[model samples]
Target: MEEGKICRTNPESSDQVKAVHMLLVSYPLQGHITPFIKLAYLIAGRGIMATLVITEFAHARMIASEPDLGNERNKVRYITVPDGLSEDERNDDVKLSQSISEVMPGHLREVIEKVNMEGNQVTCVIADPMFGWAFEIAETMKLKLAIFWTSAPGVLALILSIPKLIEDGIIDTKGSSKLDGKIQLSPDLPPLTSADFLWNYSGNQTPAEIMFQYFFGIHQNLKRSGWLLCNWFHELNPLVGNLVPNMFPVGPLLASGKPAANLWPEDLTCLSWLNKQPAGSVIYVAFGSITVLSQHQMDELALGLELVGRPFLWVKRSDLIKGGSSKYPDGYEERVANRGKIVQWAPQEQVLAHPSIACFLTHCGWNSTMDGLSMGVPFLCWPYFADQFYNRSCICNGYKVGLALSPDEYGIVTRHEIRRKLDSLVADDGIKVNALKLKDMAHRSISEGGFSARYLDNFIQQMKE
Candidate 1:
């Protein structure tokens, strides 16, 4: 943010380059795109040029037709490569992963060639681990390659220790643990049950298997990478950050003046509604962009919120329910009309920062977790899939600033259970204090001369030299 300048330097000669120009690449998912865009802004803030790369389909979906980061200078450029499929074929996670591994590199290579021919050489590429295949293209072009892991460093530590986890028979080749019990991936990290592992929940083994292989590839490439950055902060996860090499913890990665890269149009009306509510009285609910609930589960949640009878803003995404319309329980809206505001989407970071927000009811997606931490908002974790469960563990168990809502045997958070957790969270003064303390730590990590700023500055300096 150095005066919000957009610096693009052309090479005076091969012997003396002026600035670092990075190609920031991310997977098509909203989780991936959010942090990648923030990282782009972070790099560009240092007056280093950045071009954000994604699939043409993602480019159109998440990225609006407007210029990248605004008109005129457009400091960051947006480029797209075909994902080698029709819009219809891109939704299947397994197939999409395969397509990216096998098909995306060639398309990305062409884009790189085009950029080089235009005179701006791509000095570095910062990519999500999901785009591990890009390593080959970087090697082919002899470009500097870095992996931008858009998740907690604890997860990164575990993923890097897969070889040991396998050798010790803690986890099988397919990634399911050999024996189900409390397990510690390493002495320094928190103890984890099989629930923390992303693969166990997927009854289908293909995605799990693919993930295992991806972790393996990432670990293999870790040491050889030009640099590996995590969307995390050292003060937040001191132990894990200290243990991992090239693990520059420079995050809670956010860009000021830029709205979150929302795929769904945000219903900003909620902010006005929040303005009218009492300070620290509203419960903010959002389960990130994905994580659709079943009809039964949705009904339960609707009942639960009504039962809580508190001022709340719920981001019931248009796709909140699978196969069912985003409808409330019968007369649900009227029942809680005075206390609840339901929007398809809202400005999340803005909502969290608002004085009216008390605690968050979230699925514990990493980005949302970071947002909550950044705002000092305590949480009620209701994880649905993937790393969310692990993220929930980090928030509620590791950080001790949140509470977990356990679903019953049928995997539904009962209305009674929801009410109980909501009451418990609102009543917990200790958790609120812990949350604010964590928030101070988070802010300290990003402030001048702090760990995040130092790492970011070091990264830019490394890329420049």
Candidate 2:
């Protein structure tokens, strides 16, 4: 059997490659699950059989959002395991950290056993690293286990280094959440201030202690997984690649061409709006599904767009602001009438690919940044939290593809600052050209004959063998 190539069951033909059966599990968060599903689609498209497992709550959203997925009936089946929480117990605002760790693994094991009983041999278990218990399950079943870290390799390196730093007594429980002093990382790594290296250790534990415990658990499982899949590409992080050759960079796994809508309430009318704009003239802004903006911040953003005077499309989810619709600025929509377009949810890939998209005003979420880079759009980076700060640093510092904006003490991005940064990021023709060049490079990396495509083939080949 040829490696990583898709094959069919034809008795008459002798060119069949062994099909790898994969069980993919994602954490319950929307941001994490979405990317894994896209990767599963890529794998399934290559003739590998992939079963995607999600929590019951997440499964409902998937089915409700994209019915075409056809749970358990499609080429990629969807299985929903019990969340070990009552209907009332599942609240959107509360912490789900414990349920995923303590409850999910048992339900997941039962599902694995059931599938095995039904003659579906699970060749490998691919799970999110946050679901740490999966490592134990895979070991028990003697299946090859691969863990996916939905964060970047650079972030992972920082995560893995915490234990060593703790042992050296450089960081401990008594300090501030962010490091007080600047420290040099490894010689090869790009110098990041201590603040830049800090993760959001915001739960009950002290900052240093939190990082200590988190990294300790992660390192133990890191050794168990046969492979690690990261949502990064070589062009973005060649330095990290040199450090960890075994780590697979199979992404920016966004829609190559226009992808079909994964969730509903997609407003296709925005495409028509794009047609009227000149080439590379519109700013595409979306803060992703989870991040919420205060009503005041939303108003400031609106005014900021109005101040910039660029044609723009902003995705405004109805549930975004904490309060109700009353929070929206009075006469804000009417004020930006002809120049701006606002929709609830959008077909993001199509928007990014459009010739009219000049820049992306983003929250610096990894997926959005990758998508923007895939299409060659420069960014106005407003990093919210968790690895997003690191992602912003990568683009603005490492890639020269963006301009960063600092929010106020209250975390509000004022209109004046927005206007200034937008002008600077969009006006530089050389930066624009560089961004386009990077975009083309990113596209090529994911194409059929590219490095990322080959890596996908290699991983599958290893599994089948």
Candidate 3:
């Protein structure tokens, strides 16, 4: 870890420097950026000086949407870096992993040099796992860099196993046929087939190559950091977290007992509809910002929710349709108008917190899954890509907190399977009891004296050391 850059020439002015200054770097994608911002708010609100680094494009969106975050801008100051992407490439069209791989390292170095020159002096950097060059930036600045997986511990464990899988000759560039049947890699982890580790849709590398490179990068980076932080709590991943001791489970940080911070506007207004339903009466579905669905899949999904007959809130982003406007079948919205609330996006935290949200229908993106678990809502996992399938298995089997949706050979799930899982999850009395129990534990982890709280305290202390 590196010490701060000296800004004040006057000895008297040296006293003005804040002891804890953090430069928070995220993967620039919406799913990755929002949670990191929330965590930065929690840290800044607690008296630490924090600055959030964003790409030139995201910087504009933040100021326009969330102006009051910092006195500097939104409580979290901004540093704009060039993404090496043109305006056309900046849209949601590019794949996330591909976008990350293509990002230039020059802007990140420039941001560090500029920060050192400005003299605010960063003590440590919290870097997203996907932002691969952050370790190099930390090395250059000599600052302690901590990696935030932004995913669950179970996913981390599965990713960590990639190196071992390669050594065992179970995976290769083309992928393995070993996943054709049930397999148990970890004694304590859920029974997962090889498909769980498959990279599926990430554009940069094949499934096997992606898993190998991602984990290889993660392990090497961990040795350089002050400590690692996960957005999960002990109650949700006690077994895995304990196995990986240096990793801290410090989150479920949204709407954390402090007070509601409405950074993003409440679109969709699904809460009003949630209020009208009975406790645990609805299934909330959101696959996060990047997961796109085909027209056939969406229609099947609609038929599934309709078959379940439970009230539901589903986020259908403008880009969600793969072939664009033609994806929505004739009268699709009208067909589910009575039971489903179809919105572009919903206030996720509020929707999850609502008592009516019984189960979450998700793609297992780290942030969304953590939010749902933090509220103690069980899941119906429909993982789209990357480590999501691994995460889905972890939730469904590792912790028994959710159920997995098994699709057909083409990876397309039918309405019958969806309805079967939904009824089994929401109707079972044990699921609700388990959900409430998990929720209580999640709250405790983020509370003042909880495990995650203590872990965060120790992590900061290491940076000071």
Candidate 4:
């Protein structure tokens, strides 16, 4: 019943006692926050007290979207720290990274010390490796520090291979790709190209040198982390274990029983619409939080969906189109009004789990990919940037449960291509079968006594010690 103490069973009595209290810190992005929240719930389910810390800007959006977020019924406690940036400035990756480095460390240290003084001794800090500074703070406090990889194991593997890639003359020290060909990190993994380099996606939006140093710093911190936790199961990328031996896979960390910790308000009306559709007869389309489409591409996609003539639910975020309003082809809405449903956002997990959902047309963000995969939905991949192209390779080539949409010389995925890919994805019985098999494996990995469950238990036990 005291700080830094756990109950032990004796000959006279046996009792369940709180073993540890963990503080989870994530980069204030939707993709990163989603998994950290899930992991918090997972830890609390094991009788450990969990606290999740986020930037004040993200916290405000979350509270506005989900007013009941911090209710007492929730097992995890939530905290917010000033990120030292305006809401608009946070949209730029380089500015966000700079502000976080300059501002968040002292605040995080205060949080840990305050929590310790309040009788819940902070046992460990599990953080997104992107926040490399947390490692130093945890070290100063003499607490165990672990890094959580929020993306695919393959992405981590690719980051781990940066030195080798530079040695092989595939990339420069500044993270620029010297060659534009395919590469295979391991025979067991999917092949990638220079375009998939994590830092190369911004394309002049952020200075190359700044982005390069940011990612390189993260890579260095990952090597120094006491433990590495990834949000994927072993079966998904078994070869990554051989590549990064310290990595622990304890996920597909999806939320259950509580409202999702989403930054945007979800349109629950879509669920009722999904119920009206026939089983396996609807397309579920969403491109995560950050993908911005070109007007040409948006027009083409709208027409393609009309061509498919299937009942579809699409998440058309207000910021979906770049540099302008999100506008579709003339009368496109009226033409498909009877069968199509469009909303600013939807409860993605519930929509995917619905029996009426057929396949996912996705930007291939890791969280969206896992959601679709775990639900047994086949995919029509339209990766936007960052490691998304690599995730697409895993979905299409490594797992054989998805099909990639081809882009033309002008760099647009044409309307015809979308229609064709969807047709192929739906007609292929093999892909459907593989998708269900993958779903079963995902479910089993997270179940009791399963691979991920055992790894999670080991992680919790280590924290307890």
In terms of lDDT, which candidate is stronger, 1 or 4?
4
Residue-level lDDT of model 1, residues 369-407, one tens digit each, is 999999999999998777787888788877888999988
Candidate 2, superposed: residue stretches over 4 Å from native: 1-19, 71-74, 86-89, 92-94, 173-189, 200-208, 257-264, 323-326
Prediction RMSDs, each to the true structure: 4.3, 5.1, 5.0, 4.5
Go through the candidates in order and give each one's C-alpha lDDT.
0.79, 0.73, 0.70, 0.84
TM-score of candidate 1 versus the correct structure, residues matched by position:
0.92
Query: Which pairs clash (backbone N, Cα, C closer than 3 Å) in model 1?
Result: none
Order of models, best TM-score first: 4, 1, 2, 3
The list of candidate 4 runs beyond 4 A from truth reads 1-18, 178-181, 202-204, 207-209
Highest lDDT, which number? 4
Off by over 4 Å in 1: 1-18, 65-69, 72-74, 186-188, 202-210
Clash count in backbone of candidate 2: 0
For all candidates, the clash counts are 0, 0, 6, 0
Instruction: Report how far residue 263 has shifted in candidate 3, in Å.
Output: 12
Worst 10 residues of 2 by lDDT: 4-13
* Error of model 3, residue 465, in angstroms: 2.7
Superposed on all Cα atoms, model 1 deviates from the true structure by an RMSD in Å of 4.3
Candidate 3 per-residue lDDT, tens place, 1-465, comes to 012222112121233236667888877777777778777766765656667776666655655544444344234565666566667766644454566556646666666677666676777889987566878878777887888877666567765666666676666544443455665654666766665654543433345554556566766666566577878776665667544557877787784422222323346468788888888788898888777778888889888998888888987777787768635557767877877887777778888888888889999988777787778888999987677877787777666788889989987899899999999998777766777787788788778899878877777777667
Among the numbered candidates, top TM-score falls to: 4
Inter-residue clash pairs, candidate 2 = none
